[model samples]
Target: MREHNRTIAHPGTREEQMANQQGNQAQGATKKRRTFLGYLALMGPAFVVGAWQFGPGNLTTAVQAGSRFDYTLVWVIAVSTILMIFFTDMSVRLGISTPTSLITSIKGHLGKWIGVLAGFGVFGITLMFSVGNAVGSGLGLSLIFGGSPVLWTVVCTAAVGFVLAFRNVYGIVEKALLVIVVLMGLAFIASTVVAQPDWYRAMSGMVPSLPPGSEILIVALVGTNFSINAAFYTSYGVKEHRRTRSDYRDITLVDTIPGIVAPGIMTVLVIMVAAAVLGKTGAEAGTIGALASVFTPLAGPTGAMVFALGLSGAAFSSMIANATAGGTMISDALGRGAKAGSPTARIFTGVILAFGLAVTLTFQASPVGLIVIAQSLTVLIAPLLGVLIVIMANKTSLMGDLRNKWWQNLFGAIGLIAIIASSIRLITTLLG
Candidate 1:
């Protein structure tokens, strides 16, 4: 055969070149779709973590703050929410970088007893707080459907039990929470608009001030919004999602923004509505009934209904998340898996849910008191957890390149100081 030289055109014939271009476009589109879905999956855990703050406990506290002090305490929500973003970011980093649960990490670095104590504290906090969720759910149902709060509590408990029992419970929970969050946003935003708050006062409220006797309300606001258990749960939630170290980059931090911001916005709306209606009238909202009344002046009967719906959504979503946090933490503490759908997780979740139901039915405690008490108690335990997380995040061995930078450490320290101060104040208030 004669020697031959051949040169291949980049894409061969024009038809072949067009086909190749089409194929490339198709691949690009597929890649974009995959990335979009990955982002959505990453959002699941953070959204759940954020939605946890919108519970009935928070609702009660925000209502009290708004009704009692108008926008005077809105600064607390802003400050607490900013701290939430920092802590939650640390959680995401921990979850993506570490191979074990936060408790296990603490045990490895700190004393075993310290880790054990922290675990127990988280469980206790979750258990006590679950009561607020149950009561809040029941109160919401009673407000909307006109039933016994106790009866509605049992029904809501059962519904949560059914969801937790599912094999794909985390998926169900994320979707459920996302829907509930949307419902809450709509309800609160609509109510806020209807109330037509004085924008001047609302804006000025962003400036920090200590109204007389407002210390307790400020603690409640901070404690509920910047929850320690929710922060710890963020680690497990990220673990449940099975994100790799590569996912721990800035994108991870970005994903948490919506989760943090949504609940803050909801809290603000609730407060604005309360300030407009209840504060203007100097009416008290120490009870769920009174809270609902604040909404009535905003949109009449429909406003009450909307408020109840938002409250129900917050209660139910928080119920699921609170149980999951308790179950996941307790299960991890016992050396079982922390995955949301594990047998141990489900069992522990049911136990917490049952306990909450029993308490709500037996005591019939005031919803506001229940929330304030549960949230205040967290102050004692959360600082320990926050300190541990900050310490862990600073460990180069654990976090490698993703460890807390100087600014992160500075903010973390500030947050810790604020938390400790609030906790001391809470204890003092309780003691006096």
Candidate 2:
């Protein structure tokens, strides 16, 4: 133990360095295993792609699909879900290659102008994630235990923030959200099974068709929810997990599959419920509250209670996701990660929550408000991200040998076109 040590700045032996690298890589790989579970056991910390898709916004989409169009737009969600899967694969592939985030990578690859535009688009996503999650949480809390919706929302957010503020927030959030999603998914599927609608219409839904003039809004709405952004977030989430190129392909499957399957299944169940229950009534009801009311008489008090609980969970989980992504985006934009209870971190969550709360509290708007904005914004972001992904994937150095398959590119291109077309329709409707 002689202290004749080397204090000089000197490189370690090559073997020593390699060993350290391998050790670090092993630690990272362990984290990756947890990350894989993170993909499956999605709860409160971050979001699972479909988790947002099935939230309060989806309630609106499902309700309207039945209230207005019957199950004519059912296929929209199906088509969008598959597209989301494909695009999510592309995003994970590209994001894993770049050191930056999915958004930053898009910025780096796309020119300044395009990058800047996409950055603005991320703002809209911030709003969607924050408001969506908070409102959903509040709604879930309200359903589970009756209280002021706003009060419940803030309380739930604070509670969640409390958990997220802790060191081990991931597991808690993951388990809770997964339970919520499973509960919601099961209940909705039960409802769908209980009431089987016309298979003919459900099948016909897969075949895309433009309805009469303004009626196309339903299709646009469905398209909006099921589109590319779901996949884009998956890639971002994968990167957040610190996965490598080897993880890319599998990550895409693990991430996008749930995102696609959950929402797509939920979509079918919602459409089935609508077609069976309210297709003839043609109710203008678009809120989760309305669904609860409907369930009360039809399925009884328990049904209403459970449905409300699901809605609340959907909204709250969304808030968690929104805050997580929004905070990350803000920090990334400002070049700071949302670590613990920093002022900048709280602000990231707070800013988005305030924006959503203003709309919800002011107009007494329902979750549909998030959808109207969220979907439209994604309509823009999805296409832009899709194109950027295709571009990035084509660059051989980025993807290396495991670049985009021919089919991935084809789907990516189709997704871009679909998103752009949906954007045009959304804009036209807004202008008119």
Candidate 3:
């Protein structure tokens, strides 16, 4: 009776072990599910950066690359993308470690003037990007709805302003961009499917080569694709999302790698489709309208409309991200505030929109020219931005354990070299 009572009181040790194991299994499953949901929640910042990076300028350049040079330049996009991921990753770490905005952190670590200059420099690049966004948005809408391009530009600008005017501006902008990127992704994927590019040749294009007269085009491709400024703004998005160190690994897996790579893949698809559809004919799709027309002949009116919608999505999404980034950064630079919804940031955003609109209206004759010039000009400021990101990420005191790994600095060095080389080429091109 005593032995039986003791057995009942304790159960068997094996039974207790079995029960604990089952409980742990259930807990592990729940923890994994929670972790997965956390990843979904962290998806915003990088996509926003991606949307900003793959704008009208990116589209125009990719189209030009495919149509004019065929697959020879695909390697440029490949290299730019790999380097971009490194720079953006560095920015992500900085965002998580720095106490305040990236610019503020720069002020703390680098110097007040350097931070201020970085802000203005980024703002300047955004101004150039805004020109492409304004023109592309106008042209894209006109292609879809059959309206005056200028009228659509104004409407789009006002619409963006309205979106920014809301409370929780960063949150609103992030969500809006997410939707745009999804739509753009679908449209491009479908377009690529219908266009039916040559698989073997497109794969071969992965090898880098410089076809004659491709220097300037290559510069434009690197400028738009590598896009150090877009990478720089990523930290702001990270800070806005309030990501912590615990969130870093998950964020990289779910957000940073995929987010940056998504656009790179889309850009590649665009190049392949263009090469298949237009390269053989030796026809150059220099402008957005010209690019859209190429799809119509290949896939009918529906295809054309699909491509136009993608363009509109790209332009509008970029407009929002670009202006918001510029405004927020500049405001932070001037000691206003870093948050997107801050009064000064909103006002500065409006100013950016207004500047783009005014420029588009005045220089309406050459939208494509504006895009190339604007994109090329960004390289002038890009080397500086790239250096700053690498420097900030390497600061042990500032970044703690999140500081850049050695491989990161190595890639960061390569990116700086690429940007500096592009800057030199662009200057020579301008001079020549």
Candidate 4:
């Protein structure tokens, strides 16, 4: 007997070749199983993006929303998270089918100049936050150890950058950062529980509306915090998770749920913690690192350290994630993958350096200021990215059956409007 050679065949066309129909089906089933699990595993990194959203920025935004708006704006996070799921699934769908980052897709659909400008602008926004991350970490060090914040900040920048610089060998970095995010969650959860917040008021706030003379500044702060690059993380989560548009719809839904929920829950935690204590104490002022001024009465310096440590980890993970996302965008946008040093690796190196620049210079302990700059950039870009995606996803010639669904478009429109209003307000507040 002679051994058989197989020929690849197109579906439903016998003349195409002698490919095994049953075998292909089995392989696909197995692959789908793996992909579902992989998406779950990939989520740890993806959620890092959301974890960043909860950082020191939340210290003011969530608390302010709770205290001033009385949870009136609390629903915004839930709304935004849902919109993000819709928008990001579309992003991943476009990415896998088109095999491009959201940035590259925008460039391809629009023009190369837009792509170039977007690349530079996003990195610029991320750079500002990265600086905030580094500065925040330094504040953590200064508070914990009673040392020079600047010197500790430089050490942190050098350490995180040196680690990120490796790019490929970063499981240690990932695991360590994850631990920090978890610790951060535990500290906050414990504080909120101990403080015993008015869950009733918190729940009521979720009805979603603006209250008159309700510390509009704080409402703006919530908008600013949640508005900016809030979706940027969703894009990064999709890419790093490797969920090209090819995921089983069921799996995509599962993944999107966590990606959105984690941040939403984080939003609730801060509001609870802030209202439980800060509301009781009256108006308060302190840098994010110094949350002890408020929380210490509830948990003591030990508790404060735990809270700061958790927030710091959340912030650090976010910085690493954005850095990774920016690196990914650069590689994908310019068709610049690792030919020699590898695009991911090269970009990671740049990200580490950018961290130093953002923190050592522009960023500080003021979570509000850090979030403001980030939101401002987002307002400018969100609409463009939204329109670009809607156009790209709808082109039957480009995406065929993979175009975004009607609901996806509707949610995306909502996100766009929210960001637009947030942006206009940002400009008004900045100018004023």
Predicted structure with the largest lDDT when compared to the true one = 3
Per-residue lDDT of model 4, residues 261-371, tens digit only? 666776677766666666666644234543445767776777677666656566566656656556655555566741113555456547645655554665344445655
Candidates sorted by TM-score, descending order? Answer: 3, 1, 4, 2
Segments of candidate 1 deviating more than 4 angstroms: 1-34, 250-254, 279-282, 365-376
Residue pairs of candidate 3 with colliding backbone atoms:
none
Model 3, span 197-266: residue lDDT tens: 8889998999989999999899888988898998998899888887766667778988899889989998
TM-score on alpha carbons, each prediction: 0.89, 0.79, 0.90, 0.80
Rank candidates by lDDT, best first: 3, 1, 2, 4
On TM-score, the leading prediction is: 3
lDDT of 2 by residue, 19-98 (tens): 53354345445434546566453322223656655666666667667656666777677777777777666766665565
Q: Give candidate 2's error at residue 29 in angstroms.
A: 15
lDDT of 2 at 174: 54
Better of 1 and 4 by lDDT: 1
Candidate 2 local Cα displacement, residue 233, angstroms: 2.5
- Per-residue lDDT value at 335 in model 3: 87
Between candidates 2 and 3, the one scoring higher on TM-score is 3
Q: What lDDT does candidate 1 reach at residue 239? A: 76
Model 4 bad stretches (over 4 Å): 1-31, 34-39, 67-70, 169-177, 213-246, 250-254, 282-290, 338-375
* Tens-digit lDDT track of model 1 for 1-432: 122222132223333324533443344343232366666666777778878877987898898888888888888899998888889889987886665777877766676778778877888888888898898898899999897989999999999999888898888898888888888899888878777889899989999999999987888788889886788788887877766555555345456888888899899888888888875566777655687876665568898898888899999999999898888888777778767788887888899999899888778855456655665668778999999889988877567566899999988998898889889988888878
- TM for candidate 1 is 0.89
- Is candidate 1 or 2 superior in TM-score? 1
lDDT by candidate, in order shown: 0.80, 0.61, 0.85, 0.58
| Candidate 3 Cα outliers beyond 4 Å, as residue runs | 1-35, 279-283, 367-373
